[model samples]
Structure formats: C-alpha cells, structure tokens
Target: MEYTSRHTDGKRINTRSARRPCFLPGRIEGYGTKLQRDIDGKKTWNDFFFHVVAPPAMLDHGVWPDSPTGYRAANEEYCGHMMRLTRALFEHLSLGLGLEKGAMAEAFGGDELVFLQKINFYPPCPQPELTLGVAPHTDMSTLTVLVPNEVQGLQVFRDGHWYDVKHVPDALIVHIGDQIEASMNELEPN
Candidate 1:
C-alpha cells in the first residue's frame, strides 16, 4: 500500500489501515448488470460489448452473467480487492495534497461511496481498425482504475496529440476524474 516515489517525489507513504482487511464480504451488498451492449447490428460494439453493474441491481436480482458458473464469487472478490486498493490510493493522494488521510475519502462520500464497474469485453475482431471501444471523453467519477488485458488500447491526449500508453503486464491504470478536479479547484488557495 506504499505510494512509490515515482508517483510522489521521493515521498514514500503507506495508505492502508490495519482496520481494513484484505477481503470484505457484506461491504458489497449486491451486484447487477446495467446493460448488454449490442446497439449496432454487428453483434458487438466494435469488439467491445460493455456491461455495468452496481449494488442495487444485484440485490434486486437484475441481469447477471449466467453462463459463467463461478463468476459471482470471483467478481465479488475482485471488486472487494479493488475497493480496498482505491481507498488506499485515495488516502495516499490525500496525503500528497497535505490533507488528512481520510480527507479525500470524505470528499468522495465516505461510507456511502459508490463503486460501479463498467466492464468492456473485447472479443476477437477481424477488422480492428473500424471499431471504437469507447468514445473520446473524460470520466465523471472521483477516480477510475482500469484493469486492461494485454491489448494496448488506452491513450492520453496531450499537446494536440493522442499518445498510446504502452501496456505493462499486471499494471492498473488510475485516472483522476472530474470530481477530483473539482475537489482540487475547491482546495486551490484564494
């Protein structure tokens, strides 16, 4: 849980708390699938058919992946771990901004913080160039952590150019969203 010097300038900070365990059971109450993306008649959305899930849909017995027998347990476990990592990352970022460890979490809604995951499954495609996985836009959440496959797809816009971020194995990409930007603006000195 230590924030590396690369993310911080020579400052090593551990954002995890002893009270927070590795796996949380009841914390994720429920899981649900928000959509089964198949808008265009091509069967999938440019090789990427997306599905979103949240707690409410799960508890209400919403559409879930029925084919994968052991998906519920696995997805639950993955979400739990990601939540923990996100909390730690938020705290570490808070420390980076010279605020209390819980400051960012508090700003992000504390205990009521919602974590909705949008999973984009990119199947094998013959014409890869003619598809759009996701349109060019900014995320609206406080933060977003992307766990992508070996495929190099993510790009960052800079200086009138789009630069593809090289894929590194076992790496999680984190992006600060608009809410974080709004929070930073709020913190800006007069």
Candidate 2:
C-alpha cells in the first residue's frame, strides 16, 4: 500500500513507522497499497517495496495524514520529469541502433507505455551482516533506471563473483534487463 510521508500532526513518518500498519478502529486501510510478507514467516529480506504507476496517485490514498497539496503537486511534477527523461533515453537508443528516431519509444508503447517505479526502502539494520535487505534476483523488465541513494548497498554478479556497485551522488544507473538484451540480440545480423 502506498503510504503518505507524514503523520496527522504533520511530522514526517520514517520508514520504520510506515512499515508497520497502525490499524486504528474506524479508519479504513489497505487501499492502493500492498504488503508482501514472507511465506515461511521467517525473516529473509527486510525491505518496504512499493510499486508506483506513472502519474502516481498521491500516497495519501484517502487516509489520514492526507498528503499535503504541496507534496502531491511535487510528486506529480517529479513523475512527469522522470517520464520525459526516460523517453529521451529511449530515443537515444533508437538512434544509436540505426533505427527510426522513435522506433524504440514505439516499441515500448510510446505514450501508452506504463512507467512502473519499484521503490524499495531498507531501513538501517543493527546487525546488517546477519540480514539481507533484498535477495539477489534479476529484474524482469526491459530496463531498470536506478536512482542512487546515499547508502552503498548494491552488488552485481559478473562471470565469477559479485562486485559492489559504488554509489555516486547525482548519478543514474541503468541496467538492461533480460527483455532488452533479447531484443538487441534479435536485431543483430545473423
């Protein structure tokens, strides 16, 4: 479920508080937000994962600590900006591949493309070495545009070993997913 950033008193809610659902009587919840728990009930990965569709609905979700007008406006604006940036990247790829200017965008569905943002929040762990914030896995999308954070926790597996991905301020990292790699292979002269 999408969560607002603030409490009713307007104090910013940290991920720790947000992760726990405070089910108060007479208040409805579990709307537009989803909670995924481990099947085995054992602690495996500790992270808050949220899926936001492009043109994000306010995390407010008609719940208390209703998102402030300013926050909602800013989020909308930010999503639009990111969408434009992604489209530009797609165009660049199209041209670099010697395809039509809008070929890549067209393949991705142009304006109808669904821009999905997977926001993961891994809180500070006391014994981080004992817990895994996220299990290693491959993304099933065509591409993943990762917005770097202050903490350094990303690792990539190559031929024989895993290498840590260094965090750089103000840099965006794009990882080509399986679908994109397959498409590129299909385009190669056989």
**Whole-model lDDT values for every prediction:** 0.61, 0.59
Q: Could you give candidate 2's per-residue lDDT for residues 69-141 as a string of tens digits?
A: 4644565577687888888888778788887778777776666776665556554444445556666678877
Write the residue-wise lDDT of candidate 1 on 1-190 in tens digits.
Answer: 1211222563322333344232235443222121233344332322111223344343322334443577667877887898899999988998888888888888777876777765554434445455456556799988899987787778999999999998888989999999999779665321
Least accurate stretch of 10 residues (summed lDDT) in model 2? 27-36
lDDT, residue 148, model 1: 71
What's the lDDT for residue 99 in model 2? 77
Worst 10 residues of 1 by lDDT: 42-51
Error of 1 at 126 (Å): 4.4
Q: Backbone clash tally for model 1? A: 1
Q: For residue 70, give model 2's deviation from the true position in Å.
A: 3.9
Among these predicted structures, which one has the highest TM-score? Answer: 1
